[model samples]
Every structure is written in C-alpha cells, then in structure tokens.
Target: MSTLNFRRNTNNFVSGSYDKLIIIWQVYSNNQWYCQQKLNGHSNWILCLLLNNNDDLIISESEDNTIKFWIKQNQWVCQQTITYHTGIVFSLSLNDQQSKVISFSDDYQILLDRKWNVIQKIKVDKYGLRLCFINDNQFIFQSFCQEQMQIYEMDNKTKQYRRMNEITIKCGSNFDHYSFPQQYVKSKCLLVNKNGKSVNLMRKKENGDFIIEKSIEFDDQRIYGQLGQDREYLITWDNKSKEIQIRKCKER
Candidate 1:
C-alpha cells in the first residue's frame, strides 16, 4: 500500500497510498516535485498502477477488484473500469504498444485487449503477483508466494502468450516484492529493491539474461525503487522522514 511512481522523460510523478488515493506530482518552474492533483475513486487499497509519458492517462488496479482508467483534461478523473476479480487484483501490466495487457488475481491470470475487455484467462497453481512487460511481445511474471520468475512470449500464430523461460529469483524473503515501470525495465535493465534498504542495478545480456550490475545502499528502512524516465537515475522512499530521495546511476 506504500507504492509510488516517478514519470519518465518528464518532470512528473505519481503515488498511491493505503488510503485509496492517487496524487500526481510535477516539477514546475522551480524544479521541485509538487503535488499537482489528487485522484480519488477506488473504494479499497490501490494495489498497482501505470502511467505513460504525457501523464495524460493512468491505469490503476485496486484491492477492490477493479482496474480504473483515468484521463487528465481539466482534472484527473476515472473514465473506464476493468473488473473481474473476486479478491485483490495483485498486479497489472501492459505491453509497450498499449494493445495488450495482463492482470493477476486470486488463482487466475487474465489477458485483455486495449479496451480493458478480457480476451483470455488462465488458471495457475501459484498466484501471479508482479508483472512487467520485457518487450512488446514478451513479459516477465512472478508468483505471490514463490521464488519462481518466468518469461512469457506471445505466439504470433495463435495470438496467445506462453511461457518461454523461467528462473528462481532472489528476494529478501519469500514475501519481498515490488513492480517497476516497464519502459525503464527495458532500458536500465532491471529495477531492484533489496529489502527496502538498498537497490541493485541489473542489466540484461544480449541473450535476454539479466545480471546485477550495481547496488545503491540506503540507511532508511526497506523501500522500493522506481527508475527515472531517462533510466539514468532512480527514486526511492526515505522512510525515516516520509520523504522521497533520488540517486544518479553511474554510466556503464
């Protein structure tokens, strides 16, 4: 419930709290992140969200079992909904083209078209908890209570996605997890939060394998990381003072 976001390629950010609210933050002429607007809609906790560059649109899925689409014109407001879960919609992910999406809830992994309509659904033994599109045709998925990490690819012939590969991930514990922006995931390689006190940088190999490249340590309590839009910086929570901190990534 302590999740937040920093937009890329622009001086804006977003955050969702346990209170079921979304706040948009922007850096105005003063070069400071300031609250620009607050969006209210979900009746329960906001579990995950996504926003693109212009920050004109946002998609957030909540524990209330619905995905709300928001648009910004005169104000930020919800315009559409994707609801199918009986419990918490743990994670949501979209491809770069915004033409395909996936959501995980309970024991199901559902795929949707651009309009938020369910196109496909799969039942799984382990709950899908976190997701990020590795590319337009490939995605990375993690389980809620297991160390398994998997990559899925869309089969052009069938127009369906299937598991391509898998690996056992190293989490702080079986429960430590978080989601990062997919745009940054493709560029910076990977976003990592090491039990909240440190963040590790990971880069993908030419073969599509990932390796830890660097580590950024923090004295604050365990916090997650979100890559800056440029992929040259990262933002994390300063748990001690309830503030946000930014760190620059050294050039490769």
Candidate 2:
C-alpha cells in the first residue's frame, strides 16, 4: 500500500497502491474487511488521497502529476482532474471545514486553493516533508532539509498565509520527508510526532502556538510507534513483527 485513509462515521477506508489502483474497503457484520470498490484512473503510483466531509468525494494525487477526483453517484467515477500540478505531488491536506486545501509537490511550491481553484502559492526549498493545517487558518510547513518546522497562519489583512512561529526538528540531512509520522490527539490538542528513535508530543496552545510537552527515546532506533486512539496505550515494534508490544502511555 502506498497510502491509506479512513472515513469518519462509517466503517470504511480507502487504500492506494503502487499498482495504480484505489480500493475502498468496508467492514461487514462478520467483522471482516471486504473490498467494496476499486477505483482506477491514475496512470502512476498514487501518493495520497483525501475524503471530504460528506464522504461523497475522494481526491487522489499521483506520482504522474495527476490529481483525480472520484465521486460516488450510483457508482464510483472520476468526477474531474486537478490539472494545475506540474510536478510529482506528494501530499494532499484539507482545511478544517474541508473547503480549502494545500498541497506539496516536487516543484518546490506550496499551493493553496479551494475547489481546485488556485488561491495562493508559496515557494520553498523543498516539498512534502509534512504539511498539514493545524486549524482552519493555520498550518505547519517543513522543507526538504527538515531543519525547522514552521507554523503558518492565514493573515486576515492579506488574506494569504504568513509564518507565525517555528520549531527546530533538526533531524539532520540523512532523513527524508517520510522519516516521521504524526498522530493528532484531538481531545488534548496535541500532536505526536514519531521519528524512528524518538517521539515528540506537541501541544497547541490557545494563542496558536505549539510547544513540545515531552520527548521520549527508544533503544531500537527503527521501531514503528503509534499512540492508541483513546491515548491509553503506546504501541511499538521493530522489523520483527512478533516482537510488537503495547504499553500504557503513562509508563513511557
């Protein structure tokens, strides 16, 4: 799987593949996941996908620089193509209302828009390290260098984005865009950023600032770690699948 995502209010999820197909899976009464729909259109590996608020639209980006919009009528079909991207698109992120979006591409530009119409664009040194909206008017942006993670807010005066604050991730040059995974603790307004060897928990303050609350390290540097949905457990595992373990988050 290249990328996968779940839709809220339903036991359904979508998985993207290097084989250039997007499969929608649903859990039945038997509690077994079964493929319900296979969407095919993108001619290259799918990098990311986003399901909108109503779950009626799915936007997918590909390495071929193609962004396809899939909508469910009586059946799934390609609704339209987002034709402006000229480079390999790496990530697709929607705003809080699912009305606006921002994307990172190999073209080294951050493009912002609503309903496929380009609203504003910001040039950067690199693309697709980790770009996400922290709220409706604010987002976090990182470059390919990954030296710093900057927070950007949409300025009301200019009606465009402006850098508000920054945090030094300082992961160094060896790690690339996909080196870290971030999980949001919505209830606590915290974001868990997990690198190979360390996990950093960032709390978003009322003033639109993010501060690191804690940083924990693990012995096995390449371990994959995830915090539980209810913030009760922290799960970790190395390459050895059998060694996977779960422990209370408080014990970390």
Candidate number achieving the greatest TM-score relative to the actual structure: 2
Task: State the lDDT of candidate 1 residue by residue for 1-252, as single tens digits.
Answer: 456766655677788888999888888786777878888999988878787546677888887888898987798888988776666787767777776677877646555556667777765667655667777778776665354566777899997778888755444344444444223365556645243243546577888786767655555534555766566677766555566778777765
Task: Give the per-residue lDDT of model 2 (tens digit) for 91-168.
Answer: 677887888878878887788878778899888755554577777888887655454677888899998998777786
| Candidate 1 RMSD to the correct structure | 3.9
Clashing pairs in 1: 8-229, 196-222, 196-223
What overall lDDT, based on C-alpha atoms, would model 1 receive against the true structure? 0.67
TM-score of each: 0.77, 0.83
Say which candidate scores most in lDDT.
2
Clashes counted in candidate 2 amount to 0
Candidate 1 colliding pairs, count:
3
Give the per-residue Cα lDDT of candidate 2 at 57.
Answer: 87
| Span of 10 residues, lowest total lDDT, candidate 2 | 172-181
Model 1 TM-score relative to the real fold:
0.77
What are the root-mean-square deviations of the candidates from the true structure over C-alphas? Answer: 3.9, 3.2
